[model samples]
Structure formats: structure tokens, C-alpha cells
Target: MFGKKSRYYGLATVRNTDRQGRIVQAVKLRRLPAAGGVETVVTDGSQLDVMSEHQYRDGARFWHIADANSELEAGELVETTGRVINVPKR
Candidate 1:
């Protein structure tokens, strides 16, 4: 159900029962990797995808930055201007 480049691709899935008592299959939670990255300052109106494009030449690779900093929500990385964020080295 996921593309080859998707982070969830090849991950194990588990059957889960929701409150309605229906069985649902869900991808296993992916753990954040212990990554070392360079510290980058968030510029005005900075965005994760844009930063990813600038750094990795692929906007879809924004997850690398998020995972590097252990942030579940990637947007959190660019929310504050001038804030220092970790950008994973490619």
C-alpha cells in the first residue's frame, strides 16, 4: 500500500481492533534513527520541504530532517524563525 520510497514501505503491519470492534491493519511505528546532523538556522518563512530541496535536492526527503531531530511533526522544525534545527547530512 505504500510506494517504494515511502518511509512505511517494507515495515511490518499489525492487526488492531478499534473502539467499534472492527479489525484494522496498521503499519508498525517506525523508530527514529540516531542521526548526526549540522545545525542550521531557520530563516524567515522557512519550510521543511523547501529546506529538504535545498539540502538534499528532493522535497520529499524532508522526513530526514524530522527524523534526525526526533520530531514527529516535520512542520515543527520550521515554525520559529531564527530557531536552530538539525539538518541531516546526505
Candidate 2:
């Protein structure tokens, strides 16, 4: 289950059998929206989850921030402190 603010939230899950013949329920990958957001400066020890909580009031929506910034991973986006990042509008 995903959080309310998650992009995958409310998306129907598809059940599929892997090579091992094990059933797995997965959400299809979706293309993220184009980057359009306000710029924000990251302070010391800033993390994506924390920025999400601050910008969107939901820490679980950190992926939104990463996607908006065209980052493949949240960790990569937040790896550097004092960097300018984009916080997407919900």
C-alpha cells in the first residue's frame, strides 16, 4: 500500500507471474510530469523526505520531488548539501 500523496496511490495493481512462477502484485511504472516547481535551497543534512514533508506536508511523497527534478533516485538528489533543488507543486 502507498501513502495518500503517492503518485501510485489508487492505481490498480496488476498481478503477474515471474520467471519463478511466483505471483506478484505490482503497480505499473508511470511517466512523471514535466518539471515545473519553485526553487529551494538545501541546508545541511537535508534529505528528500524532509524536504517533501516541508514542501508538501507528506514525507512519503519524496519521490515527487525527485521526479520533478529528473532524479533517478531520491538519494542522488539529496546527496549534496547546500544545493538548490526544485520542490514540485502538488
Candidate 3:
């Protein structure tokens, strides 16, 4: 379960059986809102969580940055140093 401030918070979870016939609960997909943001250059050792904390004051919101930049993985987004990334406005 996600925290109150999490993007996935309060999303409906549906029960389903996987190919292996195991029951699982999955969160429903939710569309992200379109928003404008500013670009910032990442330095060596830069991390998405730190960047999120700096920009949004919530490290758990790093996915916002990833989503804004079309990155499906946070590691993929922050692994490259000196890369320009979008920091979405709250």
C-alpha cells in the first residue's frame, strides 16, 4: 500500500489470477496529468529521490520526475550524469 501523499494512494485494487493461477491484487492504471516543468542538469551521484525531495519536498514523489521525462524507470532516469531532466512543478 502507498502512503497518503503517494500518486497511487486510494487507487482501486482488483483481484486477478495470473498465468500461474495465483491470486493477486493489482492497482488500476491511472492517467497522469499533463503539466509543465523546468529543466535541470544532473550532476555526478545525482539520485531521483534526492532530486524529488529537493523539488517537491517528498522523496517518494520521484516518479513524477520520471513521468515528466517519459522514463518508466527511476534508475534509468538518474543513472546518467549531466543529463538534463524535467522537474515537474507541484
Candidate 4:
């Protein structure tokens, strides 16, 4: 289960039988919203949390930016210097 502030917090949990005949419990896939936002370059040594703090005022909300940009692996957003990423509006 996720915390109240987690992106997955309010998602529905589903139970499914896996190919191995095991029951698996998992949260449903979270759909990304269509957001209009500003683009920012990933500066050297910059992290998503830092960017989130500047944009959303809550570092834990970095997923908001990641979700807006359809990033499955958030770390990839900052893996390269000068890479541009979308920062969702508050």
C-alpha cells in the first residue's frame, strides 16, 4: 500500500492470476494526464527532487513532472545533462 501523498495512493488494487499460476496483487496502471507545462533543461548535478521543489514546492511530488512527461523511469529524466524535461504547472 502507498502513502497518502504517493501517486499510487488512490489507485485501485487488482488481483490477477499470473502465468505461473500465482495470484498477484498490484495497483492498476496510473494514467498520465495531459498537462501543459514549461520545459527545462537538466543541468549538471540536478535531480528531479530538486526540480520538483522549485516547481511544486514539494520534492516528493516529482512524479507529477514525470507523469506529465510519461516517464516510466523517473531517474532517466535527469540522466543526461542538457536534456529537456517538462515540468507540470502547480
Against the true structure, whose TM-score is highest?
4
Model 4: runs farther than 4 Å from truth?
3-5, 16-22
lDDT of each: 0.86, 0.81, 0.83, 0.86
Distance (Å) between predicted and true CA of 71, model 1? Answer: 1.9
| TM-score ranking of the models | 4, 1, 3, 2
Off by over 4 Å in 2: 1-31
Q: How many clashing pairs in candidate 1?
A: 0
**What ranges in model 3 sit over 4 Å off?**
1-6
lDDT tens digits by residue: candidate 1, 1-90? 689987788999999899999999988877766777889999889998988999899998998898888557788888888989899889
Q: How many clashes show up per model?
A: 0, 0, 0, 0
What does each candidate score in C-alpha RMSD?
Answer: 2.2, 3.7, 2.8, 2.3
Can you write out model 3's per-residue Cα lDDT over 1-90, one digit (the tens) per residue? 889987678999889999999998878755677668988888888998998999899998888888887666678877788888888988
TM-score per candidate: 0.75, 0.60, 0.66, 0.76
lDDT of 2 by residue, 1-90 (tens): 799977679987888999999999988766766778888877778888888898889998887787777566678776777778888887
- Lowest summed lDDT window (length 10), candidate 1: 28-37
Candidate 3 structure, TM-score to reference: 0.66
Tens digit of lDDT per residue, candidate 4, span 31-56?
66688999899899989899899988
Quick one: RMSD of model 2? Answer: 3.7
Better of 1 and 4 by TM-score: 4
* Global CA lDDT computed for model 2: 0.81
